[model samples]
Target chain A: MRVSLRQAFAYKLDFIFTLILGLLVSLVMIFVWYAVYANSGVSSIGGLSLNAMYVYFFMVNALSFITYNAAVAQTMQEDVQTGAVSTAMARPIGYNTNLFLNSLSVAIVGGLTVTLPMLLIAIVLSHTAVSPAALGLLLIEVLLSFAITTCIGYVIGTLSIYFVNIWGIINLTGFVYYFLGGSLAPLSLFPKWLANILMLLPSQLMMYTPAATLLGIIPMDEIIREIAVGAVWLAALVLFTLLWLRRISRRVVAVGG
Target chain B: MGLKREIKFFITCQRYNWLSFLAYRMQAFVWLSLNALFILYGILTVTIIYGVSSGISGWSYYQMLFLIGTTGITVNAVWYLCNPNGLVRQLRSGKLDSTFLRPYSRLNIMLSASGNVDNSTTAISSLIMMAYAASKIGVDAAGMLLYAALMAAGISAFVLFVMALSVLAYLLIRGANFVNGVLNFMSSSSKYPLSIFGFAGQLIFTLLLPIGIASYYPAEFVLGRLSLSSAALVFVLALLVGAASYVLFHKFMKGYVGGGG
Candidate 1:
């Protein structure tokens, strides 16, 4: 964990670039959504006033930044390509454990340096009524969101063992998460039928749930449901990851032997 | 004769790019799938935005599609042929020196070597969307020709601008990247009617970014919302941007000293 933290801290330029990208996305949404409100002459669209919509995008950007750790999958792809996974497996320390720590460190550093400040500025800029309780729950949800996304990273990373190149799949997975997870738009903007279906998907828990909760657009009951659903999703992902890892470990062993 | 040789070289480079992509069938298939999904999702985002509200004032649904399509094609086409990523790599690898050894001009060599085939499919999809939008909006024959001409100018300017950016990136990392960020911001702004961003946004995009000439002005002209004089000015503006970027790129290249590989 310490080593991973140091590694992340050393990447100052990357952090700045990532921060700029995140801010630009939020600013673009600000213009687009603000324009929509001005053009429509509506006090609120999708139950969000202009300020609330701004906060929603800000929170969405922060949450997406904190939770995104596709490096695990990408790193695994490189390792498998270079035949370094077998060497790691021979070490006394476990391979997945190290990767998990690295992922955790990355999430922690990003959240601290970039996401948290943006979240604070967003909250200060907006007049939304964010209660302490809702804010607390939102924090927990963000952590859970990070865990579930990391699980996805591991699953996709394992596919590198079977395929020669998984960068395309990795890129596709990112776009899917961004679109489906409410990073692009709030669930309220979706069609009624489409919103209902999206609500049932795990992707909603990643970005929409916490962002909506803090903005006070969603109810207390829904926040509680989000927590429960997120818990179940994390457990399922972990179990699936373990079983899949067990299956693939033997394939590596056979090839190496 | 030189122009003909450059065209032949460009086509050959494109062919090699296609061959390389076909070699990785799985990668090619997945990338194509990604482009298809981007089109689907891009259309969905526009549709949902309008479904909720009247959308940006004075613009109909098809106009936004046309604008989006034009912007997508300009950016994708420029990026496909002359990518900043490729330039960054070349600079880092000291590969610029090797390109200088080739008989072709520096710009031609750099562009041909860096050309991307994947974005060709993306540009094609945008063309389809633009055609559909034009059919819906009933743009006249003259309007269609003007749109095509402006798009050519826009693509040329954007490609040259990206070349300048790569050089700027090589010289100063964050400063150039800051401009690139602004470019991204402006490009997203271009997807909508620039009027909505007010006079300030319009000036910024037109003068600093050169984005509006590529997509917004052309789309507006086709829709009859913009005058022909305005469209002509935008076409001229696009050309000026291309020339300026070409000068800027060459100016920086003069200072670049690459040891032969």
Candidate 2:
């Protein structure tokens, strides 16, 4: 698995391009919000200072690189649609395990190559405060968030057995995450009722919680609780995915023989 | 005869899409609902921002909503109607060879070749939203008509610009998804007022990417910040850029040694 991951990273150009893209977008977001802050003149929307908002968005940008799993979902959907999953079923490994590992590998490598550098750059350039305790909490939250997000993606991908085109679903998921996850603006900007509702959705865990943790808006205990919620979501999604695969596997009549 | 044939081809494409969608109409509904959610998010974000402030750059919340709605309709229409057929796959398989061999002009064939009828729902929904927003803005009939004309021109300009860029991508890298990524980025960012990013960002959108025309410029005109002459100038610029891209793309295609099937 590691070898395959290394091979994936062997494409230096892809890694570089992805990194450059991430950085460019992060810079764009930073400049954008800078203007917003300038216009507003008062920092601390929902307990976030100007610097803190920058850090939050910067982290959102970096964490975005970490949680990138759409390609895996896409490949899985294609496999199911094209009967390529049958080939995987024929292999000795459990199909789900194979997928989980492949996704993890890609996520890890892509995260490190693109996201880690951006995070480091952001830390250096910005006036982001990162206490030792907060850093530890943020790291744990990010890991849990990634797991939950990947599982959600897996379920979405598995739904391809029934739906011919999941691209719209994927795009919709991405759009929601971008908005509701505090990517576009802080969750504090949302109406109180909307914010409360969004908290229950797993999309919030994807980018918001980690950003909040890093910004020190979320307390340590609350961060732990959020992680627990993320875990529950992940476990539920995994179980659901397994049941779905079992049902779909039985219905799979190998086509295009 | 040519126009009739083109219309028939377009209708046939739409019919095929309809039949395919019928097989999984439930899925289509689900996808459309998801798309609605996205649009709703855009509406909510703009509403919230506008609720806080008067306007981003002399345009009110309702006017910006109309801008977003129109941009969404036109961009989705272009993607569904043109992209899949013309740039992505044709470049990959060098099936553009057949396009060149066809009796029609290459530009016409390329622009009208493929359609994504599934996305028509999205386009229509966006137009409906645009109409709703326009109603809220309460423009005079003349202003509304002018807005409509500029929006039509804007959509054409955007489509032409995207097609041109896609053509450039074909020449540069046969099957690169880079242009699609950039387009996605543009669509995502354009949901907000261009003024959000400051003068530099606005200029980049206006000059380099032409995203302002997709939504911002027309909205500016509608808000009475931009004079009719400026709006006309923007429309003319869009046309000029589109023409240049078509010419440049054809010139590049001239050097093509067709690929194997």
Top-lDDT candidate index: 1
Give the alpha carbon lDDT tens digit for every residue of A210-242 in model 2. Answer: 788777787777777777777788788878877
The lowest-lDDT stretch of 10 consecutive residues in candidate 2 chain B is: B50-59
lDDT (0-100) at residue A217 of candidate 1?
A: 87
Q: Residue B142 deviation, candidate 2, in Å?
A: 1.3
TM-score winner among the candidates?
1
Task: Give chain A TM for each model in order.
Answer: 0.92, 0.87
Poorly placed runs, candidate 1 (over 4 Å): A1-18, A253-257, B174-183, B259-261
Q: Write the residue-wise lDDT of candidate 2 on B1-261 in tens digits.
A: 988877776576567656876676766776667765556756775766654444354456677788778778767777776663246577567766776686666666666555555567777778889889878887677876876777777677777777766666666555435566566667766766777776888888887888777577777787677898998998887777667666776776675677557
Q: TM-score of chain B only, all predictions?
A: 0.92, 0.84
DockQ each: 0.49, 0.37
After superposition, candidate 2 runs with Cα above 4 Å error: A1-32, A71-73, A170-179, A239-248, B1-4, B17-23, B51-57, B84-86, B113-115, B196-198
Q: Write the per-residue lDDT of candidate 1 for residues B135-162, one digit (tens) a residue.
A: 9988899889988898889878877877
TM-score of each: 0.93, 0.88
Shift of residue A216 alpha carbon in model 1, Å: 1.1
Find the 10 residues in a row with the least total lDDT in model 1 chain B. Answer: B174-183
Deviation from truth (RMSD, Å), model 2: 3.2
